[model samples]
Structure formats: structure tokens, C-alpha cells
Target: MYAALTSLHWVYLLFIILIIGVMVLRRDTTLVCIIGIFLLGLIATSSLTTALTGVFSSLIYAITQLLGTILVISIIVSLSHIMTHTGINEVMISPFTRLIKTPNHAFWIIGLLMMVVSFFFWPSPAIALLGVVLLPVALRVGLPALGAAIAMNLFGHGIALSGDYVIQGAPKLTADAAGIPVDQVIQASIPLVIVMGLVTTITAFIFMKRDMKRGILTVTSTDLQHFDEQMNQRKAPLSKGLRLFFAVLIPILLILDVVGMIIFHLQGGDATALIGGTIIFILMAISLTAYKNKGLEKITDYLINGFQFGFKVFGPVIPIAAFFYMGDAGFIDVFGKTLPAHSQGIVNDLGNALAHIAPVNTEVATATLTVVGVITGLDGSGFSGISLAGSIAHLFSATLGEGIATLTALGQLAGIWVGGGTLVPWALIPAAAICNVDAFELARRNLIPVIFGLIVTTIVAMFLV
Candidate 1:
């Protein structure tokens, strides 16, 4: 027998379709679009009851799912704040800028710095730190604020986030949905990440160079002024001896943490906490010794701001997440009164439908999931769309069987890599906001890089995963 449909199902379907349209055409915020979806959910679920209770429940459910993603973002942003206040953030980038005097040279260096720091701290913090440090240099050289934002988005959010080698947030979420070890997802994701990273980065560079050649871009004087203001806010310099010591000391310490993980077999959320904690500690030490009396105050202030930024970024996403979270059986444990062990989950059902259709190739499935992710991201919340892709993968992989987790990971990559801010104009807010660029234009510009990246990722997945 087929599963019974509620009027609410049709309503949600329509809501989602319209929301996707708004994202593509109007580029509305995900939360704002979800307001329509939520209203529909209320109308459908209430029917005669006018029961407001169901509406509240759906809202609560969606918000909770985004909490974890938001929490991770919060911690990273908070750490960036601490680093900024402690002056470690600038210290991290100073040596690199000294090495690259021109925008042409600055592109690779900034890209490299954005990639590395983002892998450790994640993208939000990386952008904040880099915006304060390198954005001005790029803008000053006539790189244009839009160009700077694109560069940051490509290397930081697209590359570093896609792989998630250090922070590992994306993999953990994918792994949980698949009932696979995080290591499996991480390892399987490596080749796909490399392929996507190369294709995406190269594509971005070509566009940037073309923009530079046409004289359509200029560096942002605002960024440089912001940098100066923040630098003045610091007011005290670290002793050359102390600065040199922490510079070498912090990298070595983080390296040891990585080594420890491999040797000791740490993975999943444990590893995320370990790496994140270490970064915070290193910043703490630098702050205490360098800032002296101001250390505690400034560092704590940074932490508060970081967490605040994180929460704001992810806040709207939480409700959208609740709806997607319903697609995963793993979440039913926490989300409902009860769910059966043998019950089919939303992701599983969707995947099973795709799997049962024998003519559909793996590449087709991958592409479909990416499209779903791109559509979901329009709601302006990346994490909200994750579970939908995860659910679809779970269903499809059960039929594939050979590398179910990897397929799931592949779908996870597509969902996050795109929805996380590559395509949807609304989701690109952070980079857009910092660069003082138009989020919609940023999204439009990303269409090429992201679509190209997905094409490469799909081909790589067909071979690698």
C-alpha cells in the first residue's frame, strides 16, 4: 500500500515550489520565503481546528534542526572574534600580505590563506579575518569589492567547506544521516573535493582576471579604513619576540592536534571539538600575554560577538532545518514521540523511489540532488536543505548498495556545497555584507562557478566514490 497523503503534503509541495521560484526569480531570504511555507503548513494542518498548535510545532521542529549547524558557526565566529581582539587574526595574515604586493599575486596568497584558515575555523570567521586583513589590498589594487567577495566565497565557502577536512561539520552531518562512520564520508569526500575545488577555483580565477582586464573593478577603500580602525583599536603591539613565538607556536600546536587525531583515531564531533578548542586556546594564550590587562575583556568580547554572528547567520535557518530534519529517521528519535526501527524515513523513501527506477543512472541521481539543494538554498538557509538531500541519498544508495555511504556523502556534498552559499542569492549574505556588494549579483555571478563545480563533482563522484 502506498503511504497516505495529508492535505498538508500537497500544501508543503506547493509551498516549496513557490519558495524555490522566489529564490530563483526574486532572490528572497530563506526565512522570508519560509513564512509562506509555514503559513501554508498552518492552513493545511489546521484545516478546521485553526489549531495554531501544529503551526507552532512545525516552527519549533524546523528551528531545532538548524541549531547544530548554527552552533558550529557560532563557535567558529566566536573564535574569530577572540583572535581579532587578541590580534592573532591579523598576525595570522600579516606575513602573507608582506609576500604578495600586487593583486595578481595577492589572489593566490589570499585564496590560500582563506582556504587554510577556513578549513580550521570554517568560512564565516575566515571571511571576517581575511576581510579585515587582505580585502583592502585586493580592493586597493582595483580588484573591486565584488571580486574580493567572489574570491573569498570560492576558496573559503566552496573549497574549504566542501571538503571540511579540519572542522568536519559537513561530513559529520552527512555521516549521521547515512549511519556511516564520519571517516568513511571524509575519506570518500577527498577526491570529489579536490576535483570540485580545482574546477571551481580555476573558473573563479578566469572570471576575476577577465574582470580585472576590463577595468570594471576596483579595491575597496572601506576595507582598508576598517582595517585601520580595528588596528588602532588594538593600539598595543606584540613584542617582535612574542609575536614571532606565537606565530610559530600556534601552527605547530594545531599541527600536533591533526597528528593526534590520525594516530589516536579521533573522528566525528569529537574531532571538531578538539580542533576548535585548540584554536581557542592558542588565541587565549596570545591574548593573555600580549594584551595584558585588556586580555580577558577583549577576548571575551570577541567570543560574544563571534557567537552572536554565528547565531544571526543561522537563526532563520533553524526552522527551515526542522522541516528537512523530518526527512531523516535518525532525527525521529529526538523529534517525535516514537518511530519504529523498521519504518522507512523520508530520505529513505525518496531514495528508494529513485533506486527502484532501474533506468536512472547514478549521475542522474547526483544531479537531481544538487538541483534540490540549489532550490532549497533559495530559502537562504543552507543547512535547512541538507536533510532533504541526505534523505534522497539514503533511499538511492540502499539500491546501489556497494557504496551507500559514499553516495550519501556525494549527495551531501552537493547539497552543502551549493546551498551553503554558492547559488542562492540570499544565502551569500555574509560575503555580500562584508564586501558591501549586492547579494543578488553575487548569487548570479556564482551560478556559473557553482554549476560548473557541480558538473565536475558529479563526474568525479561517478569515478571516485
Candidate 2:
């Protein structure tokens, strides 16, 4: 494995460590990521011009990868703006408000619903679908926006995505890599996933409640007020009948979207596109109903506002996403196969190297698998590195002669928990943007609970192994 690595690999590893350090210090990593991409291009191709060009290419690649998410979020926000302005949002959330009467009720209900939807539809679409409806309810009930974001991130991205039971995509990936039956891996993951999910969410909720009590974090009604102001600015508000009609029609349409996704087997980008397209139609209906002849122009205005907010939120994420993309397939795409012949991409190669460095034992193997999962997940894609986790689990299980299923599940859990979205600012953008909270701040708040969850989960894995 060491023999397979090159100067390019080591340089990439060094930058990964550096970037993690910067992030741990709560510093902006855009500049750092940009420099890392440049240097990696410089090292891989040894051409100054190529290095500079790679920076631009990488950003484009990241944007392309992220474009679907950005578009869905923009459309959702645009629809939300219209809903708020038409006084329809109030009606939409009124039912949920009754059930979610307190902050605690808001957190648990939103989180559990997010997790269930994410299990089938995946987190991106789940966030888009539920965020608009449930978020305002959560906020009105005194759950801060950040807390709402955290619930969606943890349960949707962290737990549902990690286990991936309904879709079985995650389990299949790890199971195949570990050379075991998918059922084995799935069965093995059950306890670990439950432990991880409970520990992390309960811990996060406790911390949030503590902060709220201390007044360090408090609910602000500004978002509701802003929407009220927007509604007042409208020359002619939608009739109460119209508002009630759309409020009823929208949820039914969204539920049908979910049914369409299930019947058509849409997931990920396909699932998100379904939701986005539905939102656009709904947005059109409301805009036309509310503004009459001016509706055509208002449609453009709403879209513009949505896109503006979308790009503004995504602007900072692009550079860092670009840099991380280079660690995987983006390297070959941006640099034209500059990696060494034997390299399994920079991230996978680094993971392999780490696997070789550690000695064999239940404890060592368990710890190493968790660490490798974290390292591979540094690219901010939990799925991108999970195959590596499976491969590494295979290597260790071969040495240990037992616990292959448990190890595979452990690695899968760690990778997805970190890169799936909970701790990755860019990856968690759906939750952050939907909840109208800062992505980085959401990541910061999630850091402790996720870390704690991983530590506890690793110990459990060690014993199970």
C-alpha cells in the first residue's frame, strides 16, 4: 500500500489534515481549500498554468455535482416565500402547531418525521418536503432555527442515511465490499445504528435545551414577522378561500409526489427533481391566484429571490466542495488521470495506507476502521468514501477472522454520520438553508454530539467485534 502512494498522495493527505485542523479551529476553509486544490494540481501535473486552471475546473465540477441540490432548495424557498406572502403558510402549519405545542415536541416530531421520510426518499428530498411545512411550526413553538436544522440533519442525514434500510443502498455497498450477505451487515448495523442515533439526538437535544435555558440560544420570531410584513405589502392578498384552498392543495400534491417517488423508484437527484417540479407548479398557482395580471411578473420576482438566496448560501460552500471533490473522481476529471497508476483515488489510497499502518486486533481494527471512515469522509461525501470503508473492513476482518459484519457496519456508520450531512456544512445545506440558519454554525453545533456518538458507537463495536 505504501509502495502505491506517491508524492501527490502524501501532499493530498497533508492538506486533508490541514483542512481538518482549520475546520476544527472554526476558521473559513474556502481559501485553504482553494490553495490545496492548486497545490494538488501543481504536484500532480507539475504545470503552473494547469494548476490555476484546475481551480476553476474543480469549482465547476463541484457546482455541477451540487446543482440539483441548489435548484431544489431555490425552488422550495421561492415557493415558501410565496406561501408566506399569500398568508397560506400560516394555514399550512396550523395543524402541526397543535401537535407541536412546545419546543421539545417540535424537536422530536420534526426529527422523527425527517428520519422516516429520509429512510425512503433520502435526506435531500425529505428536507425539501418537510422543511417548508414543519420548520415554521417548530420555530413558532420556540425551537430555534438552528435547533430545527440540527434535528433534520441528525435524524435525516445522520441516522436514516447511515442505516439506509428502505433503499438498502448503503448496506449493499458495505456488504459487497466486506464480502458478506447484505442481510448480515444490515442485521449487524441495527444495534449500532440505534445506539448512535439515540446517543447523538438525545445529547444534542440536551445541549440545545441547556443553551436555551441559559439564554445563549433563544427563539426569535423575526422570520414569522418578516413573512407577515411581506404579506402586508401585497396590494391584494389572496382571498381567505384561496389561501385555504392552496394550503390544502399543496400538502396533497406533496404527498402525491412522495407516492410518485415510491411508485417510480425515484431517489436522490430524481426524487429531489420530483419535489422541485411540484413546488414550481404550486408556486405558479399561488402567484397567479394572488396577483392576477401581475402574477406573471411576481413569478419572476419570487424565483429571483429564491435564486439569490440559493447562490448566496452556496457561494461559500463551492470552493471547499471543489477542493474535496479532487480527493475522489474529480481528480481524474480535473487533472486528466494525474494520479499514480495504482491509486484508488486520493481518499481511498489514503484509507488503504492507514489500514496498512495499524496492527491487527479487535480494538485496533475497530478504532482504525472508525478513523479511516472519518478520513475518507473528509471529502464531505459520506457515500463517496463508504466503499473504501467496506474495503478496509474486508482487510481487517480477514485479519481478525471474525466481526466482519460489525466492522463493516461500524465503518459505514462513521463515514455516513460525518460526511452524510450532519457534520459537513456543504452536504447539510438542505437542512441549513431550509431552516434559515448558518450552515457552518449548524455544523459546529452538531460536532460535539456526533463526536460523542462516534466514540460511544466505536466502543460498542469493539465489544461486538
Candidate 3:
């Protein structure tokens, strides 16, 4: 049953507005979000003490909800780090280098290779792996470094991270906030990810081809020299047999995991567990064999570094997530007895009220959610605003009466594609730095294609749901 909107509900709405306002100004909303939580709790319980405790309680609650995602990402990053040290990562990508005989070939190979590697180890590390090995090949074959960067940004960050099929961190965050299972979010994202990836990447390739025809897309001599110097200076040694073993073993193992997921009907936590377990064994086996005497110590070191990276990424997200969680019914457990009996989630109530007063049509809802997702992405972390996207998608779905999964997936693609790395100059640093291009310029080059991608994907989503 839906409860009537209360003063607390109105206050919650104001805070949401303020949070968005702060994000628009490109400022961190963590403090604003914490204040919002405190004030909302104070109004709800009419107790300063409860409000103060609720701040910490809500953060702990958010962390609890997201711990699984954080852990999985951390462990995967750890395994990736070990792979790099053992030189297995290089082995994995060596085959792709042979295909880069032309600029057009370079573009597709680099983009596809980056996308596949990023799906497993994430885009940041994938950039490091691909940039060193493949970038020079692309440049030598006539593809500009800028084109390579754009391809990596669109394919890796826009495609892989948006869907996050392997790691599932993004979907886990969105699904938890939306009160849905992680698998549902993943399944919903499949079509949307495909559409976004194709539209943005293809549009970018066309623009790149046109630029090349005008003689404006050539890699400069200075950049090529710089890249050559960097490449010569960075080489790590590993046994040939070991490299080949992992190069072949890793993909087969990961593929089997995917096959298992299909055959056993595994999804969500079960699917993630399978992936995580495989990585653990891989990490252990590699560390032991690669560093016989120091393997045990190295494993601990990798795990520590991985978790540090993982929590660091989620740090800003915690407060933002805490604020949004307060708007969900599930957070009642976090607040103990503070919430009133029969209380509805703030977001849910707002959705119900809107549905009753001025019901949103499917097109309007899709456009509005996409806009909201983009706005939330302005903070540039790509993740800070995802909880809000999930919450709002849940609300929109309730009002629209269908396509909850599709709408949530659409919001995820919008938020991640914009803020994850493409539109945000700051988030574009990894791809930009590796390619030796200006982050702002990369973002600028990415703007048109990404926007077109979002528009096309949203339209396609309207049909699917």
C-alpha cells in the first residue's frame, strides 16, 4: 500500500534537488548527501541523537549493500595486477598485434581487444596493457593516437564498463539501490550495451575516416617518438612457456565459466561467485609458480593493493549511496526502529504521487531518466550518481507499470557512458594519458558520438521494454 506524502517526503525531494545542484556545479556531494541524510533522519524521527547515529548507520548500510561488489572488483583487480607482474597479460594480447596492418584494421582490433580485456580486468588496467603494446602498431600502420584513444574510450569504458558483464560492479550498485537482483540488471543491459557500443563506436569511426581524408588525423612525429621511447623503456621478463600457458589457459577458463553460467542457469551472485573463484585460483597458481620463494608474500601484497583500489573507488560512492538508500524501504533495517511503521520509501512515495497527479508517458520517462542519468554523471566519477539512477529508475518503472529492468539498464548505460570516462575530462585521464592526448580534447571528440549513442540506445530501449 502507498502512503501519503509527508513533510519528510518533501524534505527528501528538496535534498535530492540540492544534491543534483551540487553535482551540476561539479562539486563533491558527499558532505551535502551526509547532511541530507542527517536532516531527513532528524525530521523522520524528531531526534537529533537518532539523526546523528543515522549518518554513520546509513553509510555502514550502504557499504553492507555494496560489499560484495567491492570485494569482487578488488579480487579481480588483484588477479589482474598479478597477471601483469607475471607477464601473462602481455601474452594474452600478443595475437591481436598481428592483425594491425592498416589504420582501419588498427581501429577495430584495438577497440575490440580493449573491450574484451576491459570486461575482465577493467578499463584502467586494460589501457595500460593495450596502450604499451598496441598503440605503436596502430600509429605505425597509420592510425592516429587520437583515434586509438577514442576507440579505447568508447569500447572499453563506454561498452565494457557500462555493461560490466564480467565484474558486474556497476550493475550490482544500481540493482541494490533499485531493490532488484544483480542478474536482472545484467540481463537487461545486454541489448542496451550492444546498441550503445555499436552506435558510438561506428559514429566515431566514420568521423575518424572523414578526418583522415582531410589529412587532419595523422599522428604527429613528436608523439610517435615519445611513444617509442616509452615502449623501449618498459619491458618485464617472464618465461616463454609460462606466458603461452596463461595466454591460452586464461581465456579457456573464463570461457568455461561463461558456459557454466548458461548451462547451470547461474546469474547474479552465483555468476559472480564463479568468476571470483576462478580468479582466486588463477592468482594463487600464478603467484606460486611465478615467484617461488616470495609467492606467498606477493599474493598478500596484491590482495592489499587490490582492496585499496577497490575501496578507494567506492569511497565517494558511499555517502551518495547512503543518501539514496534512505529513500528506499529496505534501509529500515539500517535505521532500526527509527522509521515509522507502515512508512513507504521516499522515492517510492514520490513515484506514486507523480503517477497519480501527472502520469509520465513512456517516451517522457525514458528521456527524463536519461537526462537525469547524464546530470548525475556530471560529477565525473561515473559511479557516484548511479545509486540515484537506480532509485529514480525504480520510481519511474513503478509509475510506468512495465520495463523496470530495461529502464534501469538504460539509466545505467547513460550514467556510465557519460561519466564513466567519455564525457568527463577528468575520468578520461587513463585513456588520454596512455594515448598522449589532451583529456578535454578526447572528451570533446567523444561528445558527439556518445550523445548520438545515448539517443539511439534510448530509442531502441523504448521498443524493447
Candidate with best lDDT? 3
C-alpha RMSD of each candidate structure in angstroms: 4.9, 7.1, 1.8
Model 2 lDDT at residue 322: 73
lDDT of each residue in 394-439, candidate 1, tens digit only: 6567656556555766676676667677666766888888777899
After superposing candidate 3 on the true structure, give the runs of residues whose Cα lies further than 4 Å from its correct spot. 338-344
Poorest 10 consecutive residues by lDDT, candidate 2: 227-236
Residue-by-residue lDDT tens digits, candidate 3, 1-465: 778788888988898888878988989999999998888878877789988998999988888877877877788889877776667877788788998899999999999999998988788878887787788888999999999999999999999999998778898878877878888888999999999999999999999999999998897888789889986785454588987998799889989998998899877777778888898888888888888888899889999998998898889999998888888854576566544445567787788888998968889878877887898889888999988888888888778888778888888889999999999999999999999999999999999999999999989888876
Rank order (by lDDT, best first):
3, 2, 1
Worst 10 residues of 3 by lDDT: 334-343
What are the TM-scores, per candidate, against the unseen true structure?
A: 0.78, 0.65, 0.95
Number of the candidate with higher TM-score, 1 or 2: 1
The runs of at least 3 residues in candidate 2 whose Cα sits more than 4 Å from the true structure, single-residue gaps closed, are: 1-3, 100-197, 200-236, 360-465
